[model samples]
Target: MVSKSRSEWSTILSHLVLAAVSLHAAVTSAQSSRGAAAGFLLQTFAAITMLVPGLNTHEDCLAGAWVATVIGLPLLAFDFHWVNGDRSSANLLLGGGMVLAVAGDHLGPEGCSVAGQAVLLVVSVTILIVAVFTANTYGIWGGAMLGVAGLLSRLEEDRLLLLPKEDVCRWALTAGSWAYCRALHTQRLQWE
Candidate 1:
């Protein structure tokens, strides 16, 4: 049996916490923004999958997580714009990007493809731009962190200090998810 490093253990624990936070955000946001809630729910599932031993190393599991993220990000972006009454071109872009992502997922390889990665990057950057323009603090931080996570994921074979790039990526993703859930929770409170 291979021994796991401290960084890996931390990453796993963080994901578990992320799952719970995402679930709570989903439930709280459901009444106000179904789209955002759905996105959060999907993310919750993705995070929970990390808890299964050795599952994260599976290609299918990785693909499923990517699928969740690709679809979830667009839903979150679309819902944020809609709730704020900013029915601009951003919403159209988000919708189109989501559809493209879904189609790409179905047509691409069993694991994540380059085309899928490109779509995810584009969608993430677009959301960041939207958040910046709309002055959403939580979204701004979340999008930025997720963007970093996405970039880091591409460097999975690399290592920093004693930790692998994947561990750093997971940490960034967890922070991003936490911020996103906070954004959703705050929005829900606003509607109350």
Candidate 2:
């Protein structure tokens, strides 16, 4: 087995922290903006995070990243509408962005194998269906992403290994999504 060097692990972890910190700051900055635009900004950030780098790969990492955006982006939009002034239409924009973002991720993995692509397709469609029927998109997305991540980590079942690079990248996206969602939730508490 080819083992990962220590430097590679360090580099991966650093990127992970960078992803979390950068997005967390964006969320904090959005707090001051206090409007539907803030949600859109976060949605934009989510697009960059997954489709760009940090979690740049063609497997569960990409799947989980899309799942996170699908879940968190909508929450950010809803909070914008219900608390940050009266922009109900922004919620729809957010919902649309969430689905579009996930679809983008599913479609863009240039290196994923047929089997890997199959996994992502199955997972994304399941989450999309649930999101359509359920009110808690966040819960559904998060759970689905976590489930796919776990499947990626498993020893068998025709899967990819969670290499150190992939590990940090995946967790970083997940952590960033959580941080932003938490910030929006905190804002909700203040309004309440």
Candidate 3:
């Protein structure tokens, strides 16, 4: 078994922190300029974390993608005010993502391949895009959290070992997306 070194762990920790801060800032903000600036900062860090050496692999990308999707759900809820309205769709997406993640974790090992993973990745991206368009703020975050979680489950099931690299990348991507969305929303508010 290969043991990760200190630097690797540090890199992962940084990524995780930035990711959390990205979402936290967005969720807590009252859609002010400060929140927008913080969101941009968070996205920038997220991109930087993804480019870290020895961390760019298919699995890492998938894991990163999953983290972004799963964690973004709540961010969306706050943005769209889903709690006040019928939140059945949001709830359904949340449940579906969880179910897929678990199912992927267990059933993924049965038949896994690089090509299959790639296809899944594409699907995840598509969902993210659709969420951005259809649901707006709510869709983007919710879709991200759900998509990433499901993808992570499948990757975990298939891989011989799970490393922090994938997770770091996932969180980074997720945070970056949140930042981007938050920034866009803030800019739009300024115009209104």
Best by TM-score: 1
TM-score of each predicted structure versus truth: 0.75, 0.35, 0.36
In order, what is each prediction's RMSD in angstroms? 3.5, 14.0, 10.1
The per-model lDDT (C-alpha) reads 0.70, 0.46, 0.46
Best by lDDT: 1
* Candidate 1, superposed: residue stretches over 4 Å from native: 1-4, 53-59, 86-94, 97-111, 185-192
Q: Per-residue lDDT of 1-192 in model 3, one digit per residue for the tens? A: 889786667656656665566656555554443433443344434444476677756566555544333333323332232332435644554454455544544545333333234333443454456445545464355346535544664544432234454554445345545544553464345446
lDDT comparing candidate 2 with the true structure:
0.46
Instruction: Rank by TM-score, highest first.
Output: 1, 3, 2
Model 2, which residues run further than 4 Å from truth?
A: 1-3, 11-57, 101-107, 110-186
Give a tens-digit lDDT track for model 1, residues 1-192.
999888778777767777787788788778777887887788788887777767666775666576666677667767766766667754775666567666764665634455545655665676677667766678788778778877776764777556767667667767876776676556555646
Model 3 has an lDDT value of 0.46
Which 10 successive residues of model 1 have the least lDDT summed? 110-119
List where candidate 3 sits over 4 angstroms from the true fold: 1-6, 19-23, 26-92, 101-105, 108-192
